[model samples]
Target: GGIITQTPKFLIGQEGQKLTLKCQQNFNHDTMYWYRQDSGKGLRLIYYSITENDLQKGDLSEGYDASREKKSSFSLTVTSAQKNEMAVFLCASSIMGFNYAEQFFGPGTRLTVL
Candidate 1:
């Protein structure tokens, strides 16, 4: 068993500022992911990394950037914060090389932009 941790549970950013969120997992999983949660929209994948320093952009990654420092850590950045925007960023991890590995999620980083 392992745990996923997100740093700075809350984030307050000014519009146009670049804000970053960090995540770390002790699960030693090979794959990590970042997703954005909107009020009405469902969870949208932002970025994923299959291995150390690898990157994959998702449907909603246009305005975001992600980095995988190693197999156990991943980080996300909001390129340009939007005004009055609120969203939650989630980090997840899954074992690789399996047919269908179940993913576990971290607490989440809540963002509020002014």
Candidate 2:
């Protein structure tokens, strides 16, 4: 019955600037993830944490940073905002069930770089 929430529904940044996005979950789950979606493209994993304070970089983690201060929340930072860039960053959590844990996703953090 819990849900994930992303803050600052919309974000505007200047090119080359760093942007940070935040997420929080009440599912009390141990695993959390961050994904990014660009226009006309599928979601790409940017970061994931199996437990609090432990972070693992995803395939698309090259230009970002993630932090898991505690299980209830996670955050991501875009290293350098590209010119006129736009994307949606998502947050998700899983209960770590045996073999097949179900993960729930937050709406997303919409970003636009001018």
lDDT winner among the candidates? 1
Q: lDDT of each prediction vs. the true structure?
A: 0.92, 0.92
Q: For model 2, what is the error of residue 67's alpha carbon versus the real structure, in angstroms, after optimal superposition?
A: 0.4
Backbone atom clashes (below 3 Å) for every candidate: 0, 0
Worst 10 residues of 2 by lDDT: 94-103
User: Compared with the true structure, what per-residue lDDT tens digits does model 2 show for residues 7-103?
Assistant: 9799999999998899999999999999999988999989999998999988999989999998899999998999988899999999863358888
lDDT of 2: 0.92
lDDT (C-alpha) at residue 29 in model 1: 93
Give the range of the ten consecutive residues with the poorest summed lDDT in model 1.
94-103
Give the TM-scores of the predictions, in the order they appear: 0.95, 0.95
